[model samples]
Target: MTKSFRNLIWAVLLVTISCSDAPKGETKTASLPVYKDVPYLQDYSIKYNKQGDKLMLSQVFMDRNEVIQVASSEGILRTHDGQFLYPGVLLQDKTYRPLTDKNITAITIYKDQFVYLDDKAVLSNAWAGSLYLKHDLPKANVFAAGNDFEFLISDGPMLQYVSKNKKNWTGVLDKDKVKAIKFNKKNSTFWILGEKSIASFNPKGQTLKTVFQNGNFTSFALLHNKLILTTLDGYLEVDATTGKQIGEKKTKLPWTEITYVDVIDGHLWFGSTKGAFMLKKDGKFDYYYGKRWLPSNNVIHISKGTDGSILILTDAGLGQIVYEEMTLFDKAQYYEKQVRNRHIRLGFNATLVDMDNGNFDTGRLSDSDNDGLWTTMYLAGEVFRYAVTKSEDALQNCREAMDAMERLFSINPVPGFPSRSFERSGYKERLHDPERWQHSDDPEWDWKSTTSSDEAIGHIFAYGAMAELMDNDLKDRAIVLIDTLMSHIVRNDLYMVDFDGKPTTWGRWNPEYVNARPKMVGDRKINASNIIGMLQTAYHFTGKEKYKEKAFDLMDNHGYLDNLMWPMKDVAKAPDDADDWSKMLSESWNHSDDEMYFIGYWGLYKYAFNDTLKTKFKDAIIDHWEIERPEKEGAWNIMTALTGTQEFDLEEAAWYLREHPMDMVSWNIMNSHRKDVTFLEPNFREQTLSEVLPPDERPVQRHNANMFRLDRNYAKDGSEEFSAGDIWLLPYWMGRYLGVISAPEKNN
Candidate 1:
C-alpha cells in the first residue's frame, strides 16, 4: 500500500481498538500542568468549581474555563491533553472513583449565564463574564476547592459557595458581617467570619463556634490541625479541632485585610497589604520582598496547583512560583547569595567587616597590618569553608588572603596580630599599599583597641578554622601566635579595669560618656569590658588558668556581672535617653548585642560545665520583638521555653520556638541608618520583650516583626545578607543545630 494509505489504515485501527485492557477495573492516571510565571497582573486568581475553573485577573477581569463537568468525577488536576485535563479521585454518589488522564472528555467554562468551550484549549482566560449575583456582592475571590464544593469571596463581604450542580450558587454565608474566610482542605471544613471573631463551620453544624473572639480577622488558613489567622492585630494559628489558639504571631503591619492564605508543603503563606511572607522553618515569619521574587509588597491573593506551583496576586502584579525539588548545589548557592555581598568589595576579596561603625568607629581606625584584620579573615573562613563546595576560585582567593596575613604575623614581632586597614582596591593592589604592610600607633593611642580584642578572638577562631582548612601547618602557627598573645596578657596581669590609673578617667569609648565608670579593682584588671569576655574565651580555648582566673575575677568579684546591662531595664530606658551617654549601667555593648550574647554564651556555657551559670545565661535570653510580626512585636520569646530548663507549656516560649511558626521580616536593621535602630532589630526586640516595652503593654506588641533575621548583615548597596555562624548558631542553641546544618537538604 502507499505511505499515505498505510498511515490512514493505522490511524483507523488505533481508533477502533479499545485503549484499556481490563473491562472490569482499570487504573487511570493524569499529569498536572506546569505553571509558568506571569508578567505583572495583580490579583490573578484561580478556583475550581463543579462546572469548570475560574481565573480572575487584577480583581477586575474574570475568565472562565471548563475544568470539570458535573457528570464527571472531581479530583486533582492530574493530567491533561491538549484540550482536556484529568483530576484526582472523585467523590460521587457515595462512591470514590479515581479518574485518569484519558477519562477527561472535554473541558468547559462557566460565567454569568454563559459556559465557554475549550476549543482553543487555553487553560485560563483573563475575563469571561460579569457577576449577576448582586451589585453589593464583593468581587470574585479565588479559593482552593475539592470534590463537590468551592468557596467564592466577593468584593462586598459575603462568602458564597458553588456546588457540583453546574449552575448552582449557594449562599452558605447569609450574614453581611463576614470579613475573612479560609477553607481547611484537609479537614474539609470552612472558617466563616463573625463581627470581631471567627466561627468554625462544618456541614453538620449550622451554628458555628466562635474560635476567635477578641479581634477582627483579616485573613486565615487551616494547616496541620491548626487554624492560622491574620488579623488587624497579628497572625494567629489555632487548633482546628478545639477553640484554643495553638500559635499566635502578631506583626507591626496593620493587617486590616489578608489578600490570600495558603498552606504549602506544611508552611502557612500569608499575603497582606504590607507584604508576602512564608512561615519560616524556625516557626517565625520570613518576608519575600526582594527583586527576583515578589514584585510588590502588597499581596492580594494566592493559590497553588496540584503540580506545586504557586500563583501570588500582588498590588502591582501576579507572581508564579514553581516549587520543585532543589539540588544540593541550588541550596548552597541560595545560602551563599544570602550571606555574601560582592558590591561593597567588588574589586576586593576581603569580607566586609562590620566593626568600627557606630561606637566601634566602623573599622576605619584600624592601622595594623591592614590585611591582618581577623574579623574579615574569620568571616572569609566561615563563608569559604561552605562556599568552597560551589566555587573553588573563590575558595583559593580566600585561602591566599589568609596565607598572606599569616605570613605578615610570621614576619612581625607581635605575638598574635590583628588586621587593621582593608584596601579598597583589588587584593593585588592591596599587596602594594603601605597600610597593608605596617601597623599603626594611632589605633592603639586613640583607644580604638577594643576592636583589637574582638579581632583577637576572631584570630583565635580563625586559627582553629584554618587548622581545619590548611592541614595543621598554618593551624600550628595560628596556635603559637595565640599562645604568644596569651602570654602577654598573663605576664602583665593586664586586666584593664581602668583606662588611666584612676577609676573616673576617660580612657575608652563609653556609651554614657562617663569617666572611668567605676572600674572593677582586681589583682588582674582589664580596661575593656569586652576584652574581659575575650580573655574568658581565650582561656577556654587554651586551658590557661591565668586567663581563666582573670576572667572569673572580673566576672564574679568586681561587678563585671553588673557591667552587662539587663536588656529589659536598658531597652526600657526613656526614648530621650535612648542615646544617652550618661547611662552607665546598660545591657548592650558594641556590635556584641543580645544575639552575640546568645551565640557567644551558647558555646561558653556549653563548655563551662556550670549548670547554674548556664541556667542564668539562658534565663538572660531577652525575648524581644520578632522581625516578622512588628504590629505585635517580640522575638522568639518562646526559645528559652523550648530549650531552657523552663517548663513546657503550649503557649510558652519553649513550645513556640518549635511550633510557633511565623514569617520573615521585610526590612533591614543595621543599614537602617540610625545608631539606636539596633533596639528595633529583630534580635533585640523579640528576645528582650520585657525590656522592649512596659509589662502592661507587652501583649499588644508581642508578635510584631515576626519575620526578621536578627543577626543578619546587609550590603551598602541594599541586598540580603546573613552569616554562616548565625545559621550555625541560631539553630544550634535553639536545639535546632541539626536543623541549621541540614536545613537546605530537608525534604519539604
Candidate 2:
C-alpha cells in the first residue's frame, strides 16, 4: 500500500478513538436558564455607643445616598464611618458627624434635606434655608416637615403649623397630650398623634379635626391616606378621611409591646421593645431579632432605606436589612468565600468556635465529630464545580480536600479505617472528645478513632464522584481509596474494624448484625443502603469482582435490597416486642440517617451493576425525597434531582438556597413565640410545625438537623458559626452538575 494511504487510515482511526473517548451523555447535561437579579435580604448592623454604653436610638432616616442618619437622645449620630459594625463597641468616627451641635430631639427628610428640631429651633440643613421656628415655643418633642418651608411642630401638649417661616395654624387636644405630628401630602394636612387621640389639622383651612380616640397611642404613620397607630398592646389601622377603624386590632403579632409603626415602601413595619418585624404580603411577619439581624433587640424606630431596604433603629444600634439583587449562583460564590476564609482547617470543613458574640475575628476553626463527612461533602462539591466550570481553583480545592481524606486512612493505625478527624497532637485536651483521639505514628499529629458508618458512606460517595468526573491523578487516587476501604470492609466481614481490632459501634453491616434489628428500625435500612452503595462504587471504580460478588450476596441472600427499598412511610417506631437497641434506634426518625441515605444515593443509583437495580434505587431515592418535601431541604431536593426526574421540587430547593441568611452566626433566634405559624402535634418525625419556616427564619443547622426546629437560644450569645460546605455548596454545585440550575443569566 502507498505511504499516503497508510497516513490517511491512521488519521481516520485516531479520529474514531477520540470520539469514543469523549465524555458520555454531554448533551443530556445541557444547562437551562436561572435568571439573575433575584432579590433577597442581606442584613448588617451600625452600632453607636459611648464609653461602652449603648446609645438610645430613637429615629432613623436616610439621605439621598441611603446613608443612615439617626436621631438619638445624644444628638444626631449616623452609622460608624457609614459602614456596618460587628458586635462590639463602635467608637465615634467621621460618619458620626452630627448635622448640628445642638441637642437635636427629632429629625425628618423634607425635599432631600435634613429638617430637624433642636433645643433652640427647628432648622434645615439646606444650604439656602434658615431656622424658621425658634425656641419661643415649648421644647419640640416631635416634628414633621411639609411642602416648601412648611413644618408641623409638637411639644407633648400643643401643635404648631408653620409655613413660609410663619406660624400659620395652632391646634391643641382638649384633654390629651401631643405625641407625634406627620404631614399627609395627599390632602395637605398635618395628622397629629396624641397620648390618647388622633386628629388632623389642615394648614390651608386652619382647621383641626379629631379622628379617633380612647387608645394609648405611642406612635403613628400615614400610608395611602390611612393612619397606623401603635399602642402598648398592638396597633390599629384607621381610615384618614372617615375616622373609622380599618379592621380589628392587630394583636396577634410576634411581639405585642408595639413601640413604633411605619409604612415604608407599601409594607407595614413594627418596632417593639423586643425587635423589629415587617408584615409580609402573605399576612405573616418576617421577624428580625437577636444579634443575627440587630445589634440589640430593643427597636425604637423603623423606616425606609435606600433601594427599598429597611432601617431598624434599636436602642443599641441601627440594623439595616438591605434587599440586594443577586442570583443563586452569586450566593454560591459568596458561600464559597465563606468556606475558604473561616471554615477550612487542615483541608477539612471545620467550624469557627468560641466566638466573642459571633465575632469571626475572635473565633478559631475547631475540629468536629463529622469532619470526614463534611470534608467529603465539600470535596464532592468542588469536584462537581470543577467538572462544570473547569475551574483551576476548584481543582486545587479538590486536591487539598482529597489529601485530607487520604490522610484520614493513613493517620489511623488500623488499615483502611478512616479517622473521624485529626489535629495537632498537643490539642487533645482542647479538641472535642479527647478520649477518641490517639497519637498517630507522626509525632505532630493525632487521629480520632471510633469512626462510624456516616464517615464511610461520605468517603465512598466523594471518592466515587471524583473517580467518575476527575482526570489522571485525582481519578487514580479516588479509585485506590475506594478499593482500600471496600477491601478492608469485605475482608473484615463487613465491619469497620477499629484500632482495638473490633467492629466500631455503628460501623457494622454484616448480615448477622443487620438482620438483628427490627425491620422498621432506621439503622438497619441505612446500613444496608450504605453498604450496597459503597460496594457498588468500589466495584465500578476498582474493577473488583469480589466487591460485586459481596454486593449481590447481600442483596440476594440477606434481604439488603428489601431493607433499602422498603417504603419510607413504613419505616417508623419499632414494635413493643423489639429489643431495646431496636426500640432506641426507632424512637424517632434520625435526620443524620437521612443525610447518609441521600449521600449514598449518589452511588447507589449511579453505579448500580444493572439497570433493574438502578431503577429500584431511583424509586427509593424519590420516595425518601417525597417524605422530605415538607422540610424543603436544599441538599436533599437537589440530590434527588440525580434521578433524572422532572418533579424534584426544584423551586423549593431554590427557595432554600435563596432564603439562607448571609450571616451564618448561630444567633439566639426565637420563633416559638411567633403567633403566625401553625404548630403540629408531636409526631414520630419530630416535625414541630405543620409548615416549616424558611432557613433564615429558623435556627441555623446542618441538613442533618430537623428543619422544623423553631428556636436556637442555647448559644449564650452566638458563640458559633457554621460553615456552608455541606449545608449549601454541596447542593448548589450538585444542581449545577445535574443541569437543573443554570448559571447566572446575562443582564440585558
Candidate 3:
C-alpha cells in the first residue's frame, strides 16, 4: 500500500475508536469527524423483517447455540435460530413452534421460567424444570420474578406471588398507589415504588422498610443492604435498613431523565432520551452515543448477549458492542502512529518537538531541558519496533530523531558537552521560560545549557540501543555519538562538565562525591549505578578495554555494588519543615531517580558481559522492583524484562497497555472526590492514593512523575496529555523485541 493510504487507514482506525481532541462546548473548530461507535464484532447479520411484521425487539436471551429469543414491542414472542416449545414446546430440550397468532401481549423470562398472557386472558407458563401449567390472571398487565418465585399482576396494583415449587400462592402487595416494581433475586425481596414512599417486601409479605419517605426518587436498585435510588437530579444511595440517605450525586439536565436503570452484567445500564451509559461497579461510567458506535442515542432497551457483548436497542436499530480485544502488537501499531502523526514534529535541522495540542500552527511548545531525553525514548522504541517488523517508516523516523539528538552535541562549543536544546535566535513564545537560554557564538541560534545528567543518560541509552539493534548506517552514527559522549565523561574527571566549566546541578558522577553522601541517601546508590552502566554500555558497543577497566575499578575500589543494592526500606525520610533543603531531599522516595534507574538498567542488563556482574546487578534490580511492584507500572516492569528475569509478569505489562485510555488529549482530571478510590491518609510524602491506580484510571501523569500522585487537579490553563510515543511504544515494542508478543498472522 502507498504510505499516505496506510496513514489514512491508521487515522481512520483511531478516530473511529476513540474521541478526538477537538474542542468541546461551542468552540469546536477542528472539523473533526463525528466519533463512530463500531461494533468490535466485525461480523454480524442484519435482518430486515417482513414489511408488516413487528420489527422492534426488546429483550434478548440465549439458549447456548440452539436458539436466540427476542421479545417484540407488541409483547409477542420471537425466536431466530430455531423453534421453541412456547406453544407446548419444551422450555427444556424441545424445539420452539412458530406462533402465527401474533396475539401474545408480553413474554417475560426470569430465572428458569417464561411467562406470557395470551389473548384469551390465559396466563401460560413454560418452565425449564418439570411441571408446566397455566393460571387465570385476567388482563394481567405486568410480569416480574425473583428467586424462582413468580409475580403475576393485574389492574389496581393487585399481585399474585407463586412459590418456586408451583405450589403456594398469595396476594403480596395490593397497594393502589404502586407506580413501579422491581425484584431483587440476590436477597429474595421485592420493592414497590410509590409517589410518596418506597417499600421493600419479603417473600413472606413482611415489610423490610419504607426506605425513602422523605425525598423524591424516580428509580432504585437494591445493592446489598443499600438502596441506590435515582432522584430527579442524580443518584442517591440510602441505607436500605434505616431508610436514611447516605450519599447523593447531583448532575445536570439530560442525565436527570434516566428512565431505565438496571444492573446488568455487573454494570448499571441506564437509558434516557439523552443517551445510554453503563456505570461500572466501581462507579466509572462509559457513555455510548449515536455518533460513536450506536444507531441512536435514544435508548429503548439495554441487554446482554451470549458471548458477553452488550446488546443495545435504540430508536433507529439494534446495536451490539463486541469486545475489541486487540492483540498487543495491533495496539502498538495504533499507538506508534498516534505519536508520529500527532505528538512528534520534525523541522529545521531535524529538530523534533512535542506539541501540547498535537498541532503545530496554533499549539504552543518550548525547548525543554530534557528534550533529548524524551526524543531518545521515542527513538529507542522505533529501533526496537524496526528490529521486530523491519518496517521502513520506523527506520526513517529514527533517522530523523537521531538527527535531532545528534545536534545537541554539536550546537554548543563545550567539547562533547550536549546542550539541553537550541532554537532559532528570536522565536521565543509567551509561555517560554527564559532563564537558562543564551546566544551561541554563531548568533543565528540560541541554546539552553547547564544541562543535567538526564540528557546524557538519554543520549547514551538511545545510541547504545541503536548500536545493538540496527544493522544500517544508523548503527555507525550511533557508535560515533556514544564514543564522543563517553570520552567527554571519562576525561572530565568522571563528571558531566557543563559549558560554564562547572558540573551542572545534577551532573556529578565522581566517586568521591557519591561516596560522601549519607548511607541512606538515594543519590549515593543511584549515581554509582548510572556511571557504571554508562561505562559498561560504552565498552560493549566500542570494544574498548579502557571503558571495561573503569567499570571494574569503580566496583572493586568504591563498593559500587553494595551501594547500588542498598535496601530501599532502610532509606531515610525527611520531616515536614518550612525550609531545610538538606533534610528535604531525603524525605520520601525520589521517583525521578526511578526513571534514571530504569534507563540505566538498559545498559546494565542488556550488555552485561560479566555473568557475575549481571547477577549482582540483577539482585539490586529485584530489590528495587519489589518495592515498586505495588505501583503496577508497565514501563518499569517491561524494562526489567531485559534482565531475562524469570516470571517477569509479561502479561501484566500488556494488560496495562490494553487498559490505558485511548483519549490522549490532556485534560485536568480530578478524582479526589471519587467514591470508588481508596485514598491514603495525608502525609508529607506525595503518593496520595493507598495504591497506584492503572494508567487510565489515575489522573494525568507523565512516565517519570510519581505514579501515586493523588492529583493532576492542577490549573488546566494548558497541560499536555500523554503521547503514545514514550507511554505506549516503550512497553509494546519492548514486548515485541523480547518475544513476549508476536505479530499477528494475516487472515486469508
True-structure RMSD, every candidate: 18.5, 8.9, 14.6
Q: Write the per-residue lDDT of candidate 2 for residues 1-748, one digit (tens) a residue.
A: 1111212222211111122322332223323322122333344444443233655656778777665567766676666543342533333324424554567788888776667787667787565656556654558768888776788887877777777755567667768888877777777788888888999887777788898986799888888777898887888888888889998888888888888887775667888877888777667777787777787788788777654667777776777766555567788898899999899999999999998876689898888879999999999999999988999989999999988999999998888888999888887355556668888999998988889998999999999999999976999999999999998999999999989888999889999999998888888888999999999999888887999999999999999999998889989988999999899999898999999999999889888899899889989999999999999998998888777665777777877877788788888888887766788889999999888887877788998899998888763678898999888899988877766666665433
Clashing pairs in 2: none
Which parts of model 1 are misplaced by more than 4 Å? 1-254, 260-270, 277-293, 320-398, 407-417, 424-450, 464-470, 487-748
Candidate 3's TM-score: 0.64
Q: What does candidate 3's lDDT look like per residue over 1-748, in tens digits?
A: 1111211222232221112332121112222222121212111112212113345545444433423444555444333321110011112112433343435544555543455544443233344334333445554444455565455343324554445464534343433345456787767777876545677767665444455775566556666677666654566667877888785564532255565566665456766555666665444455443222344455655556555556555555445554543445666677766666556644211122343322233444445667777788778888888887789999988988888777778888888887788787887461265656767887788778877777778778888889988988999999999888888989888887876788777887888777767767777788888888898889998999888888778888988877887887766654344225435556767887888888888887667667788788888887787777767777787777566555455545654666565545443443454434567876544667775665654554557877776445434322454567776787677655655444453321
Ranking by TM-score: 2, 3, 1
Q: Please give the lDDT score at residue 397 for candidate 3.
A: 86
Q: For each candidate, give its TM-score against the true structure.
A: 0.44, 0.92, 0.64
Of 2 and 3, the candidate ahead on TM-score is 2
Q: Which tens-of-lDDT digit does each residue in 488-510 have in candidate 1?
A: 54443442122222211222222
- Candidate 3: misplaced stretches above 4 Å? 1-196, 199-218, 221-261, 269-325, 347-362, 430-434, 574-582, 682-685, 717-719, 745-748
Whole-model lDDT per candidate: 0.36, 0.79, 0.61
